[model samples]
Structure formats: C-alpha cells, structure tokens
Target: MDKAEILVIGSGPAGLKAALSAAEQGAEVTLVERDPFLGGQLVKQTHMFFGSKEQYAAERGFKIAEKLSREVEAHPGIRVLCDTTALGYYDDGVVSLEVKGRFATVKPQSLIMATGAQENTLMFPNCDLPGVYGAGAVQTLMNVHGIIPGKRVAMVGAGNIGVIVSYQLLQAGVEVPAIVEALPHIGAYHVHASKVRRMGVPIYTSHTVLSAHGKDSLEKITMVAIDQDRQPVAGTEQELDVDVLCIAVGLTPLTEILFQAGCKMVYIPELGGHVAMRSDTLETSVPNIFVCGDVGGIEEASAAMVEGSIAGLTAARNFGYGKDSYEDQLAAARRELDSLRSGPVGEKIRSGLKRLSSFGEVTQ
Candidate 1:
C-alpha cells in the first residue's frame, strides 16, 4: 500500500489546490486524477473566470490550470498521479484506486475529496438522440480535442455553463441558433449574458425545449414558451432549424466514493445534490476524511481553491503539521469563505449554507 500524509482525489480546481496547499505546509501529498491529464473541467473551460485577482480571476481556465500544475510540480513533496481513479475508500484511511491499468491501494493519514461534479441530464421528448449532447461534452470536444460538436447548435438552459459554451461555440466558428431558458429571466451572470447578447444571439426566456428531431444526427429542435407551472403556452410553439442540441442544465457532485465510504450526506439542490457535511475545518463526518470544491458544493473555481486550501491546512494540522495555529487558520478560512459568498449570485448559495448548517445551530 502507498503511504502518504495527505491524499487528494480528483484533479479539478479543488484537488490540485488541496494537494499543493498540503505540500506547501510540509506534508507528503499525493494527488490522484481519473483523467489522463492534470486539469479536469478547467482544461475544457475556454472562458475567463470571475472574482478577485488572488484567485486568478479574469484569466482563462486553461491558463489557471497550467499555472496551478506548475506550482504543484515544483513541490518536491507533492506527487500527482494522473489517470488514477479512486474507486472506493475503506476503514482506517485505506483507499482503493485504479491506477495506470492496474489496481492499487493508498493509506493516508488524511484525505481530501475534491472529485468535482458531472453534468446533469434532463428528460425530454427524443432527448436520447445521437446529436443531443451535454454542454461539457461539447466543450471537451472543442477545447480539449479541437473538434467542433456540430455546425449549428441550439443550447438548452441559460445558466453560466450554457451561456459560456454558446459563446465558446461562436468563438470556435460554430453557429449558436438560440439559447432557450425555461425560467422567466436569464440564469447566468449579466456579464456572461451581455457577452453573448452583443453577438446577436437571441435568448428566449420562458422557453423550454419540447423535443429534438433527427434520425441519426440532430437536424432541428422544437421549443415552446411555458407558463409559470412549466406548461406550454398556446401559440408559443416554434421550431428552430439546427444541427445539435446541447444540454447545459447544471452539474451534480461526484459523490460515489463518499457514498461508498459511508460519509454522511445531505441532499441540498442548491449545493448541487448529495454532499458530505463538513465542519468549519472542512472535515467530514469521518474524522480523517474531508471534502471540498464542487464535490461538497457547486461554486466557482476561486471558491473551490480556497475551500481546498482550508481542507489541506486542516488535514495537515490533524496529522500534527502546523498544529499550533490550527484554530486561527481555520477561522481565517471561514472568513474568506464568507467573503466569497457575499455577492448577488451568492445569495442562493448562502441560503443553501444556512440550510446545510441548519441555521448555524450546527456546522458553526
């Protein structure tokens, strides 16, 4: 069995930051990523990030990935295992992993779960068609593999991912027919909406995709404006001639390992599905285990990095590293977390936290 002071799973913004932070704190850290590459979702994100400069905001995600990877590599104590997927976690901090075409075991004193999230799916008429694809999948094809998903695409859901992917498609010289939203208002940040709107992309609010049309590949889409209850309004049906249907509803946390490890979870939709509950120090119900980033909840990359740092620092302290000022460090992390959620878009997230923390009676 491989032994380390700290082990981080996943290679997304959270995992990389956690491993880097732990190593910087003088802990032997090992990062395991399921993908062959270092970056996870960030590598497929071609758009710039938001938030403060400290978090590398306004920079392309790929650039941030490159910078973070370099920093992680520079840490002699940090070992990153790419293409190593963690399958399960056993008692006594034993983790089962599929590494490089073989199985391996890692027994660490502390663990940070930063597995991130996966795309959510919606059921609609003819949704299983060949040309209907997840927004992230399309992004992976274009950004990572340098291949266009389709010539003309109709994007479903006006969330950040959808809006950003639509703009990316345009940047990739693909035609975005329209952005359809079931809600009465835009779902993404105004900045993202403005970027696409200026490009003459029509955003249809109060609209929903009813069905996709095609035999082998998508050729057209049927959309309709819906009432408050999501029922189609009379005479509001329309058909858009497109080649692809891209679904970008949202993402659900990748919590399979957490479930396998018997970590306590709460189903908070705002947090993006079943998430492991953590204390102020980001420690899960299991004393030696922790979770951060999208795996704990769906926030931006900036927030994930901070959360990952908190988890790493706490884990390091738990294993006798920087034990003197552990409480102070955790309190500082909590303050920074509060600051990250002190914005308009963060209101919902704040509410979710309130509920998750049970109105602060717990998790405080």
Candidate 2:
C-alpha cells in the first residue's frame, strides 16, 4: 500500500500542475500517468500555446512539457508515476492501480481527478478498419513516434483538432486530400483553417463521411455534402482513393470513474458531452474527490492547468497543508482561469459551468 497527502490522476496539463501546486503548498503529492510518458496530450502538441506569459504562452507544447518535467523533478514533495493506470476506485478513499504491471493501492486524504478526455469517434461502413484512426492517435504516431499514419489521408471533421492535425499531416509529409466538416461554415478558428488552406488542402464544409471501402484494411473513402438540416444531399457524393481516414470530430470527458466514485454527473454538450459536477474550487459531489481539466469541461490545456492549480490549493487547505493563505492562492487561481475563459472561445464554457457552480455554499 502507498499513501499521500494528495493524489492526482492523469498527468496531463491539469494533473501536472495540480500535483505541483499541492506539493508547493506543503503536501505530499502523488502524480500518476497512465502512459509510459508524462505530459499527456502535451506530448503530441507541437503548436505554440497562446495566453499570457504566466500560462507559458508562446511556448510549444512539447517544450512546455519538458519545462514542467524539470519543475516536477525539482520539487521533492511530488512523487511521479508513469506507465501507471488507476484500475478502480472505492468509497474508502482507496484507488487501485497497476504501476508498470505491479499492482498497488493508494489511500489519499484528498483526490484530484484530471483524468482528461477521450477522442470523439464517428461511425460509417468500415469505420473499424485498420486505417481508420483518431486525429490524436495520428498525431501521436507522427509527432511522438516519428511514424506517419499514412501516405494519403481523408480527414473527417473540420474542428480545431481536424484543422491542426491536417497541418501536422502536411508537416509530416502526408497528403491530406481534403477535410470534411458537417457544418456549413468551418468549425475551427480561421487561423487554423488558413494554415491548412495555405497548404492547398481543400476544406469541404457541410460535408461528412459517407462510407469507407476496403477489403482487409482501408482502401478508399467516400464523402457527401449535407443540407442545413445535416441530412445528406443525394447528388453530392465524392470519393477518394485514400488509405487512411482520420477522424477529429471532438472530445468527450472520461466520466466513468466519477460515476463509480459517486460524483454527480450531468450532460452538457457545450462542456463536451457529460461532465462531473464541480464547484468553483473543482470539488465534486463526492467527498474529497475533486475534478479539474477536461474531466470537468473540455477546455484548452492552458485553462486545464489553471483549474488544476485551484484544485491543488483547495486540496491543500482541506488537509490543513496551506490554510494560512489558501483563500488568497485560490482567489488568484480563479481570477486567472476566468481571464482565460473570457474570449469568444470560452463563451460556451461560461454557460456550461453555471450549471454546477455553488462554491460559496460550503467550505472544505
């Protein structure tokens, strides 16, 4: 058995910051990551981050991960775990996990769940073919593993992930024939769409995957245009001889653990499917189990890190680790998070969060 003053699940942008924040606040923090590597999606993000300097703005994702690694190493209060997965959670504050194939249990006084989100999936004939992959999986193969997902690709969904992955496909020498989106207008920021267009990849708005054809694996793809009602138009079918079909529809939070742990769950599309209800400090309905990052709502990595900081400080105060200035630290973290969510991209998040907020109703 192992123990810590605080336990942080999923070492992504949020978990990394949450563990570090609690450690800095004088708690013994245990940071666990399921992947063999740290940094989570940060490992695959090659693009530069945008925000204030305090949010590590202008730094590329991988560079920021390296910097976070160094910071985590410098702090003795944090214990790191890679290639570790939390297998189960119990009502007694016990989290069962397998660390490098070795089973262990951890009992933490406070728990911060930053388990992150899973890639959204799409369905069609041959959707389960070998050549069909998520944009994140393709990014990991190319950017993290230096292996191209395919020679030629048909991308589905023109959201930010789809757009960014399309650009990355170009960077990796893969051919993205086109990106198909169901919405009439591009679903991504203009800047990302512009980058892909500059590379000469066509953006097909009001389009969606019709089907994929292959014998053993993916051999070709078919797409069609849709009307304002999102129903397919009969005469707009288009086919491409592409071996790979990358799907970048969207992301959904990992909410199973929250349900099993007794946290209240609610569906909020604007917040990315179903999310665990949380207060301003990120605590869940279940005692001692706090949620941050995409698990609470599907926000950007910069925002996830700030949410982590708030949860960490909240956890610290709960265990009497940093009561003297918990309020001050928490206030500052909240302010930073609010600032990050003030832009147009954050409008949905603002409305979605209003559903679960009740921070002033109680204290830790």
Candidate 3:
C-alpha cells in the first residue's frame, strides 16, 4: 500500500497550490492528476486572470499553471503521479486508484479533494447534435489543440465562461452570430462584456436556445426571447445559421468522492450546484477529508487557490506540522478570500455561503 502524509486529488490551481503549501510545511505530499499532464483546465485558459497581485492577477492562466506545475514537480517532498485516477474512498480510509490502467491504493493521513467541476448543459430539441459542445471542450479544442470549433458559432449563457469563450472564438476568427442568455442581464464582468460588445457581438438577454437543427451536424439554431416568468414569448423565435452551439450555462461542484466518503452535502445554487458542507478551514464533516477548489464550491480560480492554501495548511497542522505559523497563514488566507468575495460580483457567492453556514436550520 502506498502511504502519504497528505494526498491531494487533482493538479489544477487548487490542487497544485494545496500540494505546494503542504509540502512547504514539511509534509510528505502526494499529488495525483487523472490527465497525462498537470494544470487541469488552467492549461486551456488563454485570458488573463483578474485579482490582486497575490493571486497572480494580470498573468495569463496558462502561465500561472506552468509556474505552479513547475514548483510542484521540483518540490522534493511531493510525489507527482500523473495519469492516475482516484477510483474511490473506502470506509477503512484507503483510497483506491487506477494509475495508468493498473490498480493501486493509498492510505493517507489526510486527503484533499480538489476534483473541480463539470459544465452544465442546456436541454433543447436536437441539443445532443454533433456540433453542440461545452465551453470547456471548445476551449480545449481551440486553445490546447489549436483546432477551430467552427466557422460560425452561437453561444448559450452570457456568464463569464460564455462571454470569455465567445471572445476567444472571435479572436480565433470564428463568427459568433449572437450570445443567448436566459437571464435578464449578462452575468459576466463589465469589462469582458464590453470587450465582446466592442467586437460587434450582440448579447441577447432573456433569450434561450429553442432548438438546434441538422441531420448529421449542427447547421442552424432557433432562439427565442423569454418572459420574466421564464416562459418563451410567442412570435419571438429567431433562427440563425451556425455550425456550432456552445453551452456555458454554468458548472456544478464535482462532489462524488466526498459523497462516497460520507461527507455532509448541501444544495447551494449560488455555489453552482450541490456541494459538500465545509468549514472555514475547508475541512468537510468527515475528519481529515478536506476539500477545495470547485469540488467544494464554484468560484473563481483565484479564490480556489486561496482555499487550497487554507486547506493544505490546516491539513498539515492536523499532523502537528506548521505549528509555528499555521494560525497566521490561515488568517491571511481567509482575509484574502473575503477580499476576493467582496463587491457586487461576489453577491451570489456571499449569499450561498450564508446559506451554507445555516445548513442545520435549512435541513431542519
């Protein structure tokens, strides 16, 4: 059986930071990534991040991923295991894994789940057509693999992902006919929204994709405006000729591992979808089973990094490591998290956290 002081499942922003922080605190850390490479979705993010300098603001996401992955690889205390899928968390505290098609098991004193999230898809007629794609899949194809998705694309959702991916598509010389959003207003940051608008992309609020049309692949799509009651308005249907329909509605926290571990779960829409109930330190109800990143809740990558740092520090402290300055580091991380979650953009996250804090009352 493989043994570790702290096992971090993921190699994204959160997992990378968690492994680094724990290793820096003199803990033997094992970092496992399912993909053959590190950096999770960060590798496909071509745009610059928005946050304070501490969060590496103004740096392109892929660059940040490179730096973090380099640190993780060079760290002597960390054992990097790429192409390893964490199968399940057993009742006896042994986590099973499949490393390159071979089964293995690791018994770690503490486990940090940074499994991230999955994109949410919209339901409509012919939505399962060939030309339909998720925002992440589009990003990977274009940014990572250097393949254009289509000549003309229509995007669903006006949130950050939709808006940003639309901008990226435009940069790649793809024609974005329009961006359809069911919400009454665009959910992206004003700067991003303005950029897309400046580029001649019209954002349709209170609109949704009604159906995709094509026999083999998407050739056209019908969109319609909706009322405040979320019902489609008659006579508002508009059809656009497009080859690709990208869905970027949102994401749901990937909490299957936490569920298998018997962690308390809660449904918090503001945090994306259902998430495991966690404490300020990012520790779940299951002792020594910490969670961070999108696995705990949906938020920006910057916030995920800070949460990873907190979870790592607290997990290492559980093993009596980092005793000298654990409190200071944890406090600093929390303050940074609060600052990141401040302002109008963070209102939804704030409300979700408020609801999560009162989980007992909510459940009762």
Candidate 4:
C-alpha cells in the first residue's frame, strides 16, 4: 500500500488547489485523476471566468487549468496519478484504486474528496438519439478535441452551461438554431445571454423540448412553450431542423465514494443533488475524510477552489503542518468563499446551504 499524508481525488480545480495547499504546508500529498490528464471540466471550458483576481478572473478557463496543472506537475511534495480510478473506501481506512487497470491501495492519514460533478440529462422521446449530448460532452468535442458537434444545434436549458456552449458552438462555426428553457427567464449571466442573442441565437423562455425525431440518428427536435406550471401550451409546438440537441439542464455531485465511506448525505437541489454533509472546515462526518467542490455541493469553480484550499489547510493543520499561519490562511479562504457567494447570483446556493445546515452537525 502506498502511504500519503493527504490524498486528493479528482484533480479538478478543487483537487489541484487542495494538493497544492497541503503540499505547501509540508504535507506528503497524492493527487489522483481518473482521466489521462488533470484539470477535470476546466480543461474543456474555453470561456473566460468571472470572479475576483484571486480566482483567476478574466482568464480563460482552459488557461487557468493549464496554469494549475503545470503547478501541480512541478510540485515536489505532491505525487500525481493520472489514469487512476479510486475504486472504494473500506472500513480499514484504505482507498482501493485501479491504476491503469492494475489494483492498488493507498492508506492516507487524510483523504480529500473533490470528485466534482456529472452532467444531468433531460428526458424526452428519442432523447437517446445519437446526436444528443450533454453540454460537457459537446464542450469536450469542440474545445478539447477540435471537433464540431453538428452544423446546427438546438440547445435545451438556458443555464450557464447551455448558453456558454451555444456561444462556443458559434465560435466553432456551428449554427445554434435556438436555446430553450422551461424556466421563465434565462439562468445564465446577463452578459452570456446577451452575447448569444447578439450572435442571432434566439432564447425561448418558458419552453421545453417535447420530443426528438430521427430514424437512425437525430435529425430534428420538437419544442413547445410551457406554462408556469410547466405544462405545454396548446398549439405552441415547433420543430427545429438541427442535427444536434445539447442538454445542459444542470449537474449533480459525484458522491459515490462518499456513500461508500458512509458519510452523512443530504439532498439540496440548488447544490445539484445529494451531497455529503460537511463542517465549515470541509471535513465530512467520517473524521479525517473531507469533501470539497461539487461532492459537497455544486458551485462555481472559484468557490470550489477556495473550499479546496480550506479543506487542505484544515487537513494539514490536523497533522501539525502550517501551524504558524494556518489560522490566517483558513480565514482568508473562508472570506473568499463568502465573497463569492455573497451576491444575488449566489442566492440559490445560499438557500441550498441553509437547508443543509438545518440538518445540524454531523458528529464524527
């Protein structure tokens, strides 16, 4: 079994920051990523992020990923295992792994779960068609692999991912016929929505995809206006002759490992889905096991990074690392997180966190 002072899973913005924070505190850190490379979803994002300077504001998402991944690769106190999947956590506190198909184990004094999230799918007739894809998949095809998804695309959900992906599709020389959202208003930032609108992509609020039509693959999709109760209105059906249908409804926290570890879980829709109950310091109910990023609750990459820093700092402090500046560093992380979630845009997340807190403390 390999040993580590701190073990961080998922190598996304959160895990990268976690490993760096702990390593800088003199901890022996091991970062694990299931993908052949690090950076998680950030690697597939081509849009510039919006946040304070500490969160790499104004920098393109992929550029931020490149910077963080480079730092992680060069960190002396951190060991990185890409193409490795953490299989499970056992009662004995050992984490089983499949590293490039071979079994391995890691016994860590502290385990930080930064597993991030998975895209949520929309349901409709023929939604399983070949050309249908999640927003993340579309992003991977266009941004990462340089492959355009389709000639004309009709997007479902006017949320950030959907709107941003639409813009990216336009950037890739693909036409976006329409963006449909069941909600009465667009869920993305006004700037993103405005940009897509200026690009001639129409956004239909109070609309939903009724069904998709194709014999072998996706050829077109039927959408309709929805009422406040979310029921389709009569005679509002419309068809878009687009080859691709992109679903960007939302995401859910990836908490399988947390479940296996027997951590307390709570359901928070605004946070995406069921998440592990964690302390303010980001430690889960299961003692030294900590959770940051989407596994705790879905939030932006900036907040996830800050939470990772908090988790790593707290975990390292548990082992006498960074005793001198631990308090200062932790306070700074907390302040950053608070600032990120302070504005009106953070209301939903704030409400979800409030619900989670109502469950009271999860005893170790």
lDDT comparison, 1 vs 3, better candidate: 3
Ranking under lDDT, best-scoring first?
3, 4, 2, 1
Residue pairs with backbone overlap in model 3:
none
State the lDDT of candidate 4 residue by residue for 325-359, as single tens digits. Answer: 99999988888888999989899999999999999
Off by over 4 Å in 4: none
* Clashing residue pairs, backbone N/CA/C < 3 A, model 1: none
Ten residues in a row with the worst lDDT in model 3? 355-364
Every model's TM-score:
0.95, 0.96, 0.98, 0.99
TM-score rank order: 4, 3, 2, 1
Q: Which ranges in model 3 have alpha carbons more than 4 Å from their true place?
A: 360-364
Q: Per-prediction count of colliding residue pairs? A: 0, 0, 0, 0
Put down candidate 2 lDDT per residue, 1-364, tens digits, no spaces: 8887799999889998998888988999889999987898998899988876889998999988888877986789988998999888887878999999999999988889999999989988889999999999999998899999889998888888899999999988899999998888887878899999988999999999989999999999889999988888998998899989999988999877788888777788878988877666788877778998999889889999999898988888788888988888888887888888897877778988775453223233
Segments of candidate 2 deviating more than 4 angstroms:
357-364
Quick one: best lDDT, which candidate? 3
lDDT of 1: 0.87
Writing each residue's lDDT as its tens digit, candidate 3 over 72-144 gives 9999999999999999998999999999999999999999999999999888999999999999999999999
Model 2 clash pairs are none
Report RMSD (Å) for each prediction in the order shown. 1.8, 1.8, 1.7, 0.8
On a 0 to 100 scale, what is the lDDT of residue 11 in model 2? 86
Location of the lowest summed lDDT over 10 successive residues in candidate 4: 292-301
- Per-residue error at 48 for model 4, in Å? 0.9
lDDT by candidate, in order shown:
0.87, 0.87, 0.93, 0.92
